[model samples]
Target: MIRTATPADVPAVHALIRELAAYEKAPQEARATEEQLREALFGERPAVFAHVAVDDVSGETVGFALWFLNFSTWRGVHGIYLEDLYVSPGARGGGHGRALLTGLAWICVERGYERLEWSVLDWNEPAIGFYEALGARPQDGWTGYRLTDGALAALGGSGH
Candidate 1:
């Protein structure tokens, strides 16, 4: 079952994130601490939200989905931007991943959101197939961009 992650689940969620990082071939990039996750999801004015899938019999956490709301000025509505979704290696080929996604889609429908979207690495053919099977289409002709850490600070300083 998929449910909203509470503060008690921070450690498990962080572990899932690290697992995902390793699967993506960037084990060193998984730097988020459990405290950081707690603050982000449970702090005053939360910046992001997360959901996790639990084993029915074992009650063990098997997957997680982290996301934030995004607004599309052109659509004049808010949508969900999925930051990450990870299913444990041992839990692959099960319905946990789809269940998590279906839960998010339900949230969007309940909230009147225009879309639920995310990006996948071009080399991740399995993931691409999974999403496509769910009837999700890629936004072609668009290139993704990022500005983080030092680059983000440098850009803001230049604006000064």
Candidate 2:
């Protein structure tokens, strides 16, 4: 039961984000507010698109995957950058994760996207295995970088 998420799903989405952060041992960093999520996701220019997996009988969201389109200059085709994917602890290993991945793959194929990409923490070996089993491989030569609030401010002040 996977479907696109709507504005009405913000609360549940926010809760899932918090849960994922907690699972990654960074609960305090899960500070996304409902208003922020709503505006970013459903605004005139959406920041990302979300797909949620719901339990058939319970009608509760069990997992979700958020993604945005990115261009691969080298490949000369669009790609899907998977920002996040989380399945509730109780619902894991119940095919939800695989279903979500399958749904994302379908989106890629249907839209003619050349690639689908995501990152998993080095400590999460199980996730690595899961992704590998799904035929996803790590881009060996790449490293991820980020700029947070203070760093972003400093960079802005530097004025290049």
Candidate 3:
């Protein structure tokens, strides 16, 4: 079952995040702490939201979807920007991932949002196939970019 993550679910979700990072071959980049996640997800005026998927038999939180709002200039509507979605390896064939995504899609449709989007690593062919099976297509012409670490600081004119 998929449901909104409560504060009690933070640690489990945090672990799931580590698993995701490892799978993505970037374990070193999973630096956010549990306290940071708690504050981000449950703080006053929260800027992020999360949902967890529970195992039917074990009742364990086996998956999670963390997201935030993004505004589309062309559509003039706020859409969900999924930051991460992960399901435990043992739970892969149980549809947890699809259920998590379906929940987000429901939110978009219910709120009249024009888009539900997230980026997938180019080398993760299994994930690409899964998303395609769900009727999700790549935004072919657009390239994703980010400025972080020294580049981000330098651009902001702040020496780190």
* Whole-model lDDT per candidate: 0.94, 0.91, 0.96
Worst 10 residues of 3 by lDDT: 151-160
Residue range with the least summed lDDT across 10 consecutive positions in model 1: 85-94
* Over 4 Å off, model 1: none
lDDT of 3 by residue, 1-160 (tens): 9999999999999999999999999999999999999999999978999999999999999999999999999989999999999999999989999999999999999999989999999999999999999999999999999999999878888644
What global local distance difference test value does model 3 have?
0.96
* Model 2 spans > 4 angstroms off: none
Worst 10 residues of 2 by lDDT: 31-40
Clashes of 2: 0
lDDT by residue (1-160, candidate 1, tens digit) is: 8899999999999988888998999999888899988999999999899999999889999999999999999999999999999899788788999999999999999999989999999999999999999999999999999998999999999976
TM-score top scorer: 3
What digit string (tens of lDDT, one per residue) describes model 2 on residues 1-160?
8889998898998899999999999999988898998888999999799999899889999889988999999989898999999999899888898999899899889988989999999999889999999899989999999998999999999986
Clashing residue pairs for model 3: none
Candidate 3's TM-score: 0.97
> Candidate 3: where is the Cα deviation over 4 Å?
158-160
